[model samples]
Target: MNMNESFQTLNFLPRGKFKVELVPGVSKTNFLSICYGALTTIGLLTFISYSTNYVLLENLAYERSQIGTIVGNLQVIAEIVLLSIFLPIGLIADKIGRRQVYSFGMLTMGLAYFLYPLATGIAELTVYRVIYAIGMGTATGMLGTVTADYPQNHTRGKMIAVTGILNATGVIIVSLFFARLPKTFADMGFDQITAGKYSMWIVAATCVITAVVVALGLQKGTPTEEQKKIPYLKQIKAGLAEGRKPRIQLVYASAFVARADLVIIGTFLVLWGTMAGKDMGMTTAEAQSAARIVFVTSSMSALVASPIIGYLIDKVDRIKAVSFCMAIAAAGYLSMFFINDVLSPDVKPLFVLLGVGHQCAFFAATTLLGQEAPKMKRGAIVGVFNLAGAAGILISTGIGGKIYDVIGPYAPFVLIGFCNIAVSLFAIYVSKTSPDVKEA
Candidate 1:
């Protein structure tokens, strides 16, 4: 099918469909990249639902106030582990093919999911989560690199938009199935814990299959421009130096906001919605289904928003694009402040706004990072991007959890709103002062 025809069939918004230069020739690599994007999102969404649900279950099993403490510690532990290994994973991927690292990361992630339901206490869960973070951290870095690697400059935006659509679709599908799976199973005969475990095992099995597919389907490519002639420390020093560029700094900052955007919604929104539902006298299963609907709404918005945002990234000044998106995100989060009820009908528009903002910022940030980073050092640079993201998730979850318990259920969203505004201002400053880097 022609590009225009495909866009027509997808029925994108009138403003979204645009004339573009298309790349010729399709290959296994392109298909593998799409599959990897979709699979990654599925894995991520399932894990997120599992973690948040586990936190809610723990609150009931233990003390409610510990909600903040447990979730905070889990995130802090996982981020710390990710921070430690991310650079090393990138360095290793640079040495070997990205396919090997990608496959290994997927395997490790599957093992971690397999172990999640076996945890008897917070300590055990923490241990498994740290293990899970390694896989997550590695896969996250390579996904960006691989996506950057696959498409020509003219087609890169379209490729990214397609990946984003697939990812949002994956999240929607997983959330639809597994978000209520425990409750669905409970209705049949299984206990809550058993049902949760069954759902988790399904994710684990899928992760293993994804890993095998990646190993078999992806072709080997030389990732680095040259073999490292420098010592490890010097290469590390060089990668660190690259982060100091003005545009690169902005991308790093965007990483902070983008990751925080994701972690907040995934961690807090589910908790808030579920807790509110439970307070409304809903059963655990019913509460979870209700809570998960928020993500469904958000993902649906992102699925539609992706192509438009991707097109803009290719056409506009990237920093300005990022600033605009962040501003929109800030407004979305601000909408939460006036929301008295988590289950209110008014909430969906706010989430839709949030979803669009996050997806746009995600595309803008990663595209800028991919375009600006030195090709030889791209893997390590993307690692730095993921590292900043890890820090954001750590800070957002760790501090936001406390705010949820201490200030109010909605206070975390308010804080995130302010953070978004702050970053948007920074983006504006970068756009004005720095020379624009063309994507090609």
Candidate 2:
């Protein structure tokens, strides 16, 4: 069968069908460079993320604390909005040209981050973030499509996994080094808050420069008939069905659940730590510093694990990897419930477990999602996966926060621990059987 017809069989979204400009054995250096650029954006995000709820701390709480909730809400709300928006963006990339979409996304990141210093409250911050989310949705959908544009899957996974390591690199950079930039500026008599803002401005500048390099250096591919043969709307019906396979669905579900666990940590675990220990002798910053240690350590481990996981994903059973990851994470989370000395100087080991457990799940989930999603409908598949994961964040935030408020600070950790264990079992049971879909 021809490439067009094979794509027709994989029908993703009615409008999402775009032709692959990738001639078999095409050079991947361009794609690799672009992925590296995207990783820089990830690093930029890691740095600004610490500022997301900065105002909510007891210290920053008085600095217009109400805006904290609003800023936090922007991320959740944007995730939902992106669900609807990126579906078409993916299809558009398929139809118009992916280079257009990719460049636009970087520009959005540049612009969004540039505006960070000016945002003073929920309303202004929300506007800037929504733009960032739109950029994110575009990048999320396009990266897999761009990778598949290559002829090989293994090579594709390797390149993509490199980006994952870059993500870990970004996290470690901001957590370990960005935290200290403030003091450097303070030595020159700058206010701590002003110095922090300068750090964000630097991240913004990096994104802007990356966007420029991509816009100028990257070549654009012509649109193809892979999607032109089908109407955009009717295509989703065919796409989801064509794309659906039993084992893939189970794997897909594993990503959905695993990412949900991750989103929970990204959204609320740090907040939970500070709130939980107000009377236990640790200040919010101290709790955050301790948690940052976990993130830094895990980010370091991811540097090593990413390529290996990428290698194993295609060769070994993807589900088995997912199951093993969930089991370890479950053990780590459960350990929190039983350990009494969470704040002891010796509690540092738990951070390593938290890091390893979470990073393993992250590496596995992204590898699986990209591997399993059909080229034609990657946008919708990613959208659905993201939708489910976003809901995970929403629920974790709402439920975890409420539990902490009603039960005590320690309640959320206990909840997370039990959840990791339970979800691991569910994922394993699902993976035991084969997915009904055959490999394309």
Overall lDDT per candidate, in order of appearance:
0.73, 0.57
Kindly list the per-residue Cα lDDT of model 1 for residues 1-440, writing each as its tens digit. Answer: 23343222222345535433323333544454545655564436445544545544732375656676577677788889988888887777777767788878778888887888788877787788888888877777777777766566655666678777777877777777777777888789987777777777777787787777777766565444474544556667777898887788888888888877777777778878877777898866778788888878887898899878888777877778778888888887777787778788876788898788778777777777767777677777877888888888788878888888898777777787888888789988888889667553
lDDT of 2 by residue, 1-440 (tens): 12342221211125523112333433344544555665665555554455554433432343332332443455567667666665577667666766677768777776776675566655676787788777766665565455545424444445446566776676677667664454456567876466556756666677667666656544465334565555767655554663456545554555555655554555444444334344466544444555555456546766666666655655566666677776777665555555444445465566567656766676666666656666666655555555555555555545555555556445555666665566566557756666442332
Q: After superposition, how far is residue 345 of candidate 2 from its true place, in Å?
A: 4.7
Model 2 backbone overlap count: 13
| Residue pairs with backbone overlap in model 1 | none
The top-ranked prediction according to lDDT is 1
Worst 10 residues of 2 by lDDT: 4-13
